[model samples]
Target: MIRTEFPEALYLLILIPFFFIIHYIYIKKKKARLNNLVDKELIKTIAPEISYGKLWTKFTLLNLAYAFIVIAISNPQIGTAIEKSERNGTDLMVCLDISNSMLAEDIKPNRISRAKQSLNNLINQLNNDRIGIIIFAGSAYVQLPITNDYSAAKTFIDVIDPSMISNQGTAIGEALEIANESFGEKNKNKSKSIILISDGEDNEEEAVSIAKK
Candidate 1:
């Protein structure tokens, strides 16, 4: 992606045409003064090296060079590969609670709806980090495999509801396990995190143990 650091400098381009017009006027006045001082044919014979076409061509080239200089001053930049930079960001897996209890309007509209909105906002703030989603109720499943496809993550998040899972309780431990599995073995060595967004309701006592693993 090409970006200009000083986009306002592009307004200087308008000066190019103004410069040409002024030069044209100056050239016309010079010609008029020269015609008054000497015959046109005589002037041409006296200054055979001064071709009007060549002068105009030189001015055009100079103006183009000036335009290029102005553009350079604007500091146009191109996107560069970040392969050499150290990989510092974490791979995030969001484990969202989509149980029927999330449908309660206690948190304005519902917990599940608010969670989805917050997740979407979180996705918007990410840069280059891989993200995935896990929806859980009585059981858990990977709604999206871990990847850098943030758009797909949001898409999966938008469609999440209690109906997606037939099981009818909040199994935080099973959800944590499913989220762990979804991360895959390839990213195990890398910085990773599972964000469990629930209403502090855990029916399964094994959640703490699963999280420790």
Candidate 2:
């Protein structure tokens, strides 16, 4: 099975027949004009090497060469292909705090933006790992499900803000619980872990206890 990289190049083939017709008309006109202006015996004596059949053959060969050149430009290829992918990294859940405290001016350009930048950097270093995101304020929510697609994870992280959660407070315990549930209760993956980003302001005292479990 053969296929061309540029199927559009085939459109040039249509002009070949048009060119042949034009050449035929031009040759006929030139021959008639020569016969009218010059004697046949004198023409044969002056140009004894000229053969109409040979001239036509050369023109056909030129057009065939042009067609071959176009086909070469199209970069035709043969055979099929197969691809394989392997995953060998661990799973991780990132729990980000979007409470009002993250808006503190102590950090340069505020706290949330820096956190997101840090998260993006961390994501850049990961390979073949399934990562999920949990954004929490007064309540907890899963912003991205567990997946190996790091690009989509970075996109979702770029748009995270405190405004996403209407209830504006810290619920660290709930965030941890949501992450745990997302990891699933019977998952045997020992490499699974959670990354929590917060400003040390929280009402949930059981956050540490839940993380331990």
Candidate 3:
């Protein structure tokens, strides 16, 4: 996983040999100047501090320092960013009717309770498919936007009550329209569907013909 951010900086390594060539020419010129000033045997006696071997050591250290700098400039990094893969499955929009009549005790504890239980079970059975919720009484509104997060969906569904909306009638057409819109335009070419749960008391706020589209 270790990688260099600037691999191009590694080209600086090529300058090391040229540094050595320049150091050699400079050392030769110093020696030639000393030969003109004094005999080769007496040069070391006159210049006690001037050691050609020490100059080579200094040049070698400088080159090492330059090499380390080049590597530092390359900026090596560890680990990599994880890429998220898209989940492939159908999209389902649940249009649940929460009108006052849905609270009738005809179906076990109440009709709305039973419908909510069914929604939770459906979510349990879902695999990678995305789901959304639209609660409709006299009007429709998105309770949950389309998402694959089943836990959040369950949290939203468990708290749904018939008393949430003041308007009390089954707006199935409005529910269907909102459900269609919630599917989104990008999913037009994909598999999309809606599951309507109601007590069969619809006032038809809008034409359901849009559902066919």
Sorted on TM-score, highest at the top, how do the candidates line up?
A: 1, 3, 2
Question: How far out, in Å, is residue 164 in model 2?
Answer: 0.3
- Give the Å error, residue 16, model 1: 49
- Per-residue lDDT tens digits for candidate 3, residues 60-161, read 998999999999999988998699987678899999999998889989899999999999999999989999999989888999999999999999999999
TM-score of each: 0.58, 0.57, 0.57
Please report how far candidate 2 places residue 87 from its true position, in Å: 6.2
Where does candidate 3 clash, by residue pair?
none
lDDT, candidates in the order shown = 0.87, 0.89, 0.89
Please write out the lDDT profile of model 1 over residues 10-66, one tens digit for every residue.
999999999999999989998889889999899879988867888899999999999
Question: Ten-residue segment with the worst summed lDDT in candidate 2?
Answer: 182-191
Tell me how far the alpha carbon of residue 147 in candidate 2 is from the true structure, in angstroms, after superposition: 1.2
User: Whole-model lDDT, candidate 1?
Assistant: 0.87
lDDT of each residue in 67-106, candidate 2, tens digit only: 9998988889897756586766788999999988898979
